[model samples]
Target: MTVSPATASAPLARTPLDRRVEPDLRVALCAAICVGLALLWWVRGGWIFPLDDAYITLHNARVLIEGHDPNYGVPALVGASSLIHLSLVTAFSLVLPGEAAAYLVAGIGPVLFLAGLLTLAQRLSLPWPEGIALALAGLASGTGQFLNGLETGLVMAAVTWTLVLALDRPSRLLALICGLLPFLRPELGLLSLILMTRQTWSRLAAGSDRAAALRAVAADAALALAAASPWLLWNLAATGALLPRTMAAKQAFFGHPPGSLPASVVYAAAMTAGGIGPAAAALLFLGRDGPGPALLWFVSLFILGFALTNREVLAHNGYRYTFALLPIALFAVMRLGAARGPSVLRLLILAQWAVALAVAVAAPTEIAAQQERVAQYRAVAHWAQANLPQARLLIHDAGVIATASDLPLTDLVGLKSPDSIADHRRWTAPSNGAERFRALDAIARRSGVTHAIILDDAPDHFWASLADDLRRGGWSLDPIETGSARGPYILYRLAPPTDPAAK
Candidate 1:
């Protein structure tokens, strides 16, 4: 009934569990739930992920398993958003089939994610039930994102447990994990950067033993970087950039300043809902105690960065970027003792599971719809793979195509082709559709692109009125062959090689 501000490091000793419960028992519940959900998904979708991007990683894993060069046209076609996720799936594929390996790594993340909550509960000495509630509430806030094949469960597990470790005390282990953040997911690296920035500021402001504090900061920062050095060095060596081509691709295709009031509110509101507290709670608990200040710092700055960088302003991307703020909020409200784990938590937990269940029921159908489009494109892709073996296919999205056929691809959005980043920009430019199509058609012709396909149903922000654009641009469309996959796809023949040998 009372709100008390305390430091994030303060002990949550108000109500310890009266009965002892084995940690493994809590862990087993998490593992069981994860398996059950995966089974439900597999039964319906047959290993097709709700997100096509999952297949990108799956395809790359198979490439590694076969000992083929992972890179395609470019040496830096790292091909996955998470190097860590790709590496884990590749390792799992050594013993299991490629699809099953992807499935296993996928399941481990949520298991570790929920298990880490129990670990947090034990460290806080809270009752076991509260731990499960926090975990479920987490699922609710980002239910759809976790199953997205972005290695979300893993990213969350690392972030949540890292927060847990940071709360306990600083250690070499914590430094190692903090350094590994970017490999988990690039957005997560922001968490470490923000937390360290807070630590550096606090120490400097204290005005005592300044040299000692600076040395400590430098050493910890070095350790964190050292832990991440391999992935960092490899990216730099291969791509000549610190971040992957994905960043460049995103910047070109969907990057926009977060200037719109409505878009900003929707983005902030989603964070507020996920954190399960009013947005103002961030200001209240910040700098009061615990990781609350640092986490709030991370979320705010991340939102700022995203607003400046993204055109897709909704909270969850098909490639999920949100993580850990829920735990941070839960920790904040609980440590502050605000409303003492409100009764509303029960309703919220039920709602989250309901969403997860709903996703399980609906995701298969959604995947089927995507597959219909994938099949539409696949006809062109398969023919190129067999008939014109040396030619590369250019397409809008790269995930399913990467796995479905052996055809090499130049990603229209540039995930696999950094050189096309400008083309991606032109394709998604705010310009009229006909103008956009002419610009792209010219580029494709010059690049010797013939087997090019694009989705007619992409978001308007990406491109608009494609059928009109093609007609206006003096272009004719080739309909895909008859099948279940026949849909609104346009194949443009930009100078198909006449002689079979010319291709």
Candidate 2:
């Protein structure tokens, strides 16, 4: 049997990565990393993340903890983009309160991600300095999401370990985990395919057991399908779709075509290029010797998938969708071992790490300030809870408000509300006020919404514009009158149509 060059990177049939280091010490190091990052963000900033989306994830955890159907005050819809994180936080919250549980789970993401990078670096035997820099760069790139209390870190953790297993372990267990990747986040599902392809190919290239490798790949695929079956079936049964609506909602919101490449090309490129860390991660792939081209392939496919799906807004929410690419790039670096490229490559790598570290260090205060701004939104939610306890509320600024109050909610952004969830494409399309008006009006009427609580930046123009067409004359303005925040919002008493004859 002849071994191809591709087999050169294959792991020895032994446990690797810090294998020489004591297990207890490794665990201690991971814990310290998790705790250190958590304090660096939360103690300096605040308990909550700066973004409203974090609270949306938190809300799902709370609902699960309370044993309610996972809905944002409606049935047949799960509000969170990541059910995996939701379930994890819910499980964690059973031992701790929802907020603390969420915080702990969130912190675990970066730690797992860092540990993964270090493990891979050790397995591949990269220089210690480069390994640490690469690991920190990956962590820093996603610091916002890790600290924000969302599933970005979990997604990274999952991807890292999946890669680790695929490259080093290569078993049926890995394939099964890959199968559940989409439920974690849609991008990971794509990664699952790419990884399995590489893994299967690598085994074939080994020339040791062609028949056994083929059988193993088949078994892995079957296990993955088995792992993923429940989610797909449940979604199809409940929502008439095989995939979650969250992706569709976001694509629509950003005016990304659900099926296209031409229109999305520039946007997707901009999204990919927007972050120095993610870009540098891909760059690391260029000047290294590797048996396979997994990272490059995945990144290309990711951008292509984004274009076809029209999911730009890459720079949104701390580049949440793109952050996974950072750790993945580092993983590629580990697989390829240290770069033997020009000195410029090393300097550029160091520069990427420095920028990422600076952003992460400064993020706490910035995030805290942003949360302070959201205080008004929370205040408004509290006001509605106290004053209009029975208000069937239609709300913008969905996240913090949903967590802050129990006033029945119909997310004005259509992320949660049953009436509005599928209407994102219709409303978000490049259309005039009338089209968006009919969309929102239908949601308001369908939900039997008596009042609306819309909070936006300063004048609250975006939400206000969406509500403009409704016959909402003399609606209450600034109902709560809280301190300076992102915005002071309006709670409207949506009037019945002024013209009785006009339907």
Candidate 3:
């Protein structure tokens, strides 16, 4: 393959403070370098920092690994499911157990995601180095909630590549895989359907075989429906609708007195940009495309629609929920820089990598610095995992607690209520309000939750309300030990005996 001049200098340019190397091994070289950088980021800040939503996925895997049915409480709530992680749990269950398997799975998921994305770019006729650059761009951008510890990165990569392959060949096997996309992430699956529908409509308008297009559409839809059947069935049984997993959380948030569109917009913007810079920049540059600019317009509208509807902005920000549109964003960027020489394109790509590396390196210690004030909350999480019987403990902040403790959280308060479970499918914090708190307490009691976890950051928040309720119910707050600068986390255990004299 002939290398473009612009692409050649990208990795070779010397920075005064940063090391640089020109890639020569083509795909292998580019991929290896990118993987090395990701590893550096993962090791430097991510390894110890705890992935935002990784704990929930890890918890689910742990359940299966431990020979227990991996129930993250979605079955009884609003009816949502994650077959991809469930499958991982089953695979890990065969040999590895507990945190051992969970960590491996968690770490590998992102790599797979990056690979799948590169595969998709290849299908689009992008050269290997270009594809690698795009994949790295996706990772660094943090769009689609890459930094959220949600499995969106991998899941999106899988779904996007699946669609690309499906479109290129439209094979039964590829179609089948494409159909199962919804099983990995429902929102992305729905987005796939929408994009396919648009494509099919265009084909029909162009005088292609209508019957064939109809068949293709039907096949795709059937596969999607079949893949989603588990959740649909669960929802029918639980909530009487094929709604989000946490329908209760959604109702609670929407019904809040102060909640409205303006608030959602604020949350959405924060989610779109919070901590993840490259992805955000890609999204902003999506308009710089072709003669018709059809793809650009389509993606922009798609994301804008999602933002308008998205309610609760999650902790990992809005990475997962918005990840479905990232491929289009990347494609747009690729096209924008296509006119520039290859070296310049590679340089831009290298710059993105540099930024991601800098951000990740700074994140760990910066986050550690703030851990002291949040120590009490982390301590309680540790105590709950150690002392209390682990029968589906419910927590407000799934990432902060579940990832740190390597414990499974049964129910997250606001996962489906506009926050999108793509981050922490098993756990999410409730939106602000008195009703939200009451709902959290009610769910804890009804679901037979063994323990409740709380942080003192917000007095009127769900954690505070749960603490007050537990205290009234005669529960004692015990301190738990933790690592690093994390403060004392208070575990609210149900009081032992009514009579102190009995002891």
Candidate 4:
């Protein structure tokens, strides 16, 4: 008797065709377990360490909430990217509370980032369990310091969502969001856009319908223009240039006689190794046969390129700007799953997560300690606010002091804008520390720049000179010890000197 076609095509081995899903389910469950472990490790660590640039972000948000320009309290070393991102979070926080805003950002950033990448993985035809596992690995690799009490997670979430948009839909609304990336952190955003747009255009070109391609391009352009309008309009109103605050920070920090080439390279290297292991970084760029290796490559390239191009010296506090391009870490993990087999990829991803967890634990607990210093400025800012009527205060340290106090702000650090200072000597040369002190004193006397508060722990060069000048001028310095406050800080009251020169 001849076997029927259906009987001849019977299910292989033991399981019936209808119930052949056990293997996939088992793989998926295992993947879920791996991913869950990594996420658990991350959330276990509450938001700690305000980080190097976190103070700047927090200051910007608080300043906006206090009815000051977002630029107020912006440190000399920070970029406007952080200020812009935090300003939006501040808007949310304003309706709620600062801590509420912080929690919202901490929770929402990861959720949004994970959701977007999962959607993109679906679009790429990755298996659901496999996609989640890869995405989780990518998350662990990219978000090494994500749990920190700052806006880095928000920025990374935005970038991840941006990539998802680029891959899955390529809609104009997504493009608008993508355009906003550069404003948050130009280097990462710009590079990512270049790669994403190129890939998008390539896909569009391959499509049979010319009309569809044209619409996609038009949509991208429209969204980009709309999202970028604020930066351009703000520049026109403030500095008459499309670039606000970014150029100023660059010129001040990297575009000096020494330049910031070494610093840029170091930052790039640190970023590559920061979230995922260095091996992951290498695989991201080198992995050619991965499912979405092109996307991962672009993500990594943009992140690394933007970081290095900034060319600024590494801040001692931490490289907080690295947060902006952190999505590449997630992308790298996804590539690992695609290029290597799922089982091998699972082991590698777990190892990467373990690295991130280790680093997370090793990081110091005193991350947000600077909140105390910010408190110091709050104590004295009241006196300045009541007595002096200036819209902005130039502080020696752009800590919580600037943010806690309801004052528009500037920094004397010469990191934000080298040209803000009349004398180039102070910024370029070490002796300019004395000149800066004298200049601050002169400004206080002439411009009614009410206060020149200094931190006892701040750099000796500038703080010492300012203190000396205040003393010599007979300006009585009233010190408020921090023990009387909620956090660490000092309040100095500068009164007009009995002798004019003594001030």
Candidate 5:
């Protein structure tokens, strides 16, 4: 009676032999190789950020850590591109100096990005081989942007993790991520909105009771709104605007002459396909089921947003805006191959992995190119900090130099200066160089600007007219002697009008 099978505890269910085998070995190997490639690329480049925008965040982080609002040492505006990103960088800066923080952030970005990729691959139920390929594609697609120290990698990780969690089930954590999305990057809010709406609608359609579905939707909405409220309130209070001044300036710059929308969209799509490697071609034919629709919507909306705002800017930014779409594209491709057969999927993965390996091999050249481009600004920043430390300079590319020099800067581009934004808004005409120069001059005088720094190769009409106006206005223009192959940046020194008539 005591030995009765029902009364006796059954032997614990034996763990499946397959389950005991490490599933992540190949994934881990791929991540190590890719991350090593990224680190190698950074080391070759001397661990410098590849973009000037990164320095802007560094500067702001330093400001925040030093017990000031993240601004260019002037009026407190929400000038940092992402408050959350700035906060993280500021935290790192507290532990390390500004430059060291930048490098540390850059190195950490790929790790977070790869972790998110692996999590997504697991959530998608992809086999380890396919997961390796996905990791490769992600590393190849995102390495440059990650190294550049933009919000690209952080946004990528957030977007991938959010999508993975949302696809599994509704949770408060997912809602929280949705709420915090905009603080990562304003455009990323589109992903949050799309995903939340889709999830809520799916629940409503599937639920037996309409009221229950409505409650769930309301809960999700409330969580998202609550999480997002801080940034919204802060921006409103600090800047009297919901969006950053950068958004307004970008809209003003890129929203015009709205080149053929279809053409812009097509061009962006082509560029994205090329950047994501051979796997992107497979995304075109993937079924709408699985992660395809979410990915398609994300990529389509991004391209459409670029078309409406500034396709040229997207193209010029090394196709960085599209890098966020890479993981999704790779996921779609993996899913397509898996649906066909494991063998087919494995072959596709191999092909994509080979492409990624090529990208890794070529990374050194890309790093060199980026280093050369960034060197000019860095050198000029050092020069200005040393020689013209006291000059109140009006600058076009204000991020690197202003941060580096600790200069009192009036950003003619409007990113750091509310007054510059006001001037930009006041002048609605197409970029007339002389008129633009006059507006800048007005802002300069108002800000007590005694010197100016302008990129000689700047495509804006303002650059075209700068030298002429400098001479006519009793400002002497001298090209800064940075031996950069990119070109010379001009530095102008203001002198009191020699001619009484000019005054």
Candidate 6:
């Protein structure tokens, strides 16, 4: 057979897949680096419980495993932020002690997150060096939350893989992941919505058959609904609400401040810049034909959502809410660098690795700082547990101390109480602190609360007012001195009013 010139050149015209280099060795090397960093974090600070919020999940898990309502004594309230995460921790707690299971899950989370990033990079078919660098960058970006035991790492991994799969092609797995997202974190469902919308649009734009596109959309919807129905039904039955109480509480507490929208956008843009620097800008502006739209959509939606609802909360906790952007930014860099040349890719990879390495090295210090903040709370919890074992306590930071103390607690912030949320809504004005505290005091008295634990540096004005009210209103304000590194938490002993008519 005669070989034509066109046919010979066709091989060179083949897609990038034909030119793609094997990434297994690079994947292994990246995985090894990630594992080493994870191990360093584990050895240094992984075991220390840094966030009080984590204990709320742990406590709920225990309650569920023991066949009670997940909200401890609050039978009808759905307090946990992530039902799926709580269920997973609950399953682990069944085999191990609750605290141990919580720590173990948190400890293993970063390792899995790192592995997921490398897998994603390999899936994207970047050069091995770039893949390793991206994974390292992801590791560095998430170090704080990975050590703190929040669902941030798990959600980040899930979002990365789901986006990868959905962008590559729509499938039943994508649908299933979409369904499970809300259970992981309610806001994560937004990611699923974005992916689904993008996939549907892509299918239609590609001139695929209408019937096929319809079928794909239908399947995605059905599977997502199936995966999410149980949680949705449970929430409806338990809380008579579509979302958890925690969501409402957060929304109420951190509703968009007037004129802050522009500032919020600036803050989010700044965060994206800090995470990926000029590379992200280059990818967005220069690589418009690539993943720019998707990246831009994700980042913009995330920023707007938080800005309108809880940008301050996002700002707190080391910018964990924005952690998903790290992987997205890395993906953009990979695409941009590959289009540019190997030299550009190498430089980007090196820069990413340096950032990641610095974060990994500083993991211990971050953990220690977090530990110091919670030290006073831990001491107070221990003291309360030992001395006032039967006293029902009113607590502002309701997770760790309440869990550790094993006392009946009225959570003023409402993570574990439905009534507290209702009360907060009734007292939304800035001037209502005195009235709110008075109402809270009444509620506490009705609930038989004999003591209150208040943090000295609590930023909430209502909490500060409550403390002052207790001091002047006949409650004995005794500051318990702890040798803890963090100082000044008060343990107030509630005393009955001197006159019966005063009540």
- Best-matching candidate per TM-score: 2
Assess every candidate by TM-score: 0.80, 0.84, 0.65, 0.66, 0.83, 0.82
Model 5 misses residue 413 by how many Å? 1.2
A best-first ranking of the candidates according to their TM-score comes to 2, 5, 6, 1, 4, 3
lDDT of 1: 0.60
lDDT (Cα, tens digit) per residue for candidate 1, span 1-503: 11233233454444223333435567577868777877865785645455667777877777666756332455522656688888898888899876677777877777777777666655554445654665665555555555556677787788778877777544566777878888877878888777666655655666688897788778878888898999888778767877666765666655454357567655654654543333224334544465666777776776666655663533434325545455565555444433344344344445555545665566556656765655565565565566666655657667666676766666655676666567657654444222455444544444555565666665643433543444444545455442334555555444432432221
Name the regions of candidate 3 deviating beyond 4 angstroms. Answer: 1-53, 62-81, 116-134, 141-149, 159-163, 166-174, 202-217, 220-244, 247-270, 273-320, 339-354, 364-394, 397-437, 440-451, 457-488, 493-503
Q: Answer with 2 or 4, whichever has the higher lDDT.
A: 2
The predicted structure with the larger lDDT, 1 or 3, is 1
User: Per-residue lDDT of 1-503 in model 3, one digit per residue for the tens?
Assistant: 32333221122233432221223333464467457746755675433324334444554455434544233433322323455655664577568643444444545545555665565444343455676776766665543234333456556567555545533434445545545665566555555555455545554665568887777767766775666677556546654665445434443433322455666556655654543444455544434312114444444454454455434433323344555555655554454454454564466567666766775666556545444434445555555556654645556655456434645454435542223332222222233343333444344444565655565545445445656644443445453343434543344444332543221
Highest lDDT: which candidate? 5
Off by over 4 Å in 2: 1-29, 37-46, 69-77, 202-211, 257-263, 276-291, 332-345, 430-434, 458-464, 467-486, 500-503
How many clashes does the backbone of model 6 have? 0
lDDT, residue 451, candidate 1: 61
Return the TM-score for candidate 6, rounded to 2 decimals.
0.82
Q: lDDT at 464 for candidate 6?
A: 61
> Candidate 5, after superposition: displacement of residue 7 in Å?
42
lDDT of 5 at 275: 66
Candidates' C-alpha lDDT: 0.60, 0.65, 0.49, 0.52, 0.66, 0.65
TM-score of 2: 0.84
Local error of candidate 2 at 409, Å?
1.7
Off by over 4 Å in 4: 1-87, 117-150, 207-212, 250-267, 275-280, 283-317, 368-394, 406-410, 414-426, 429-451, 456-503
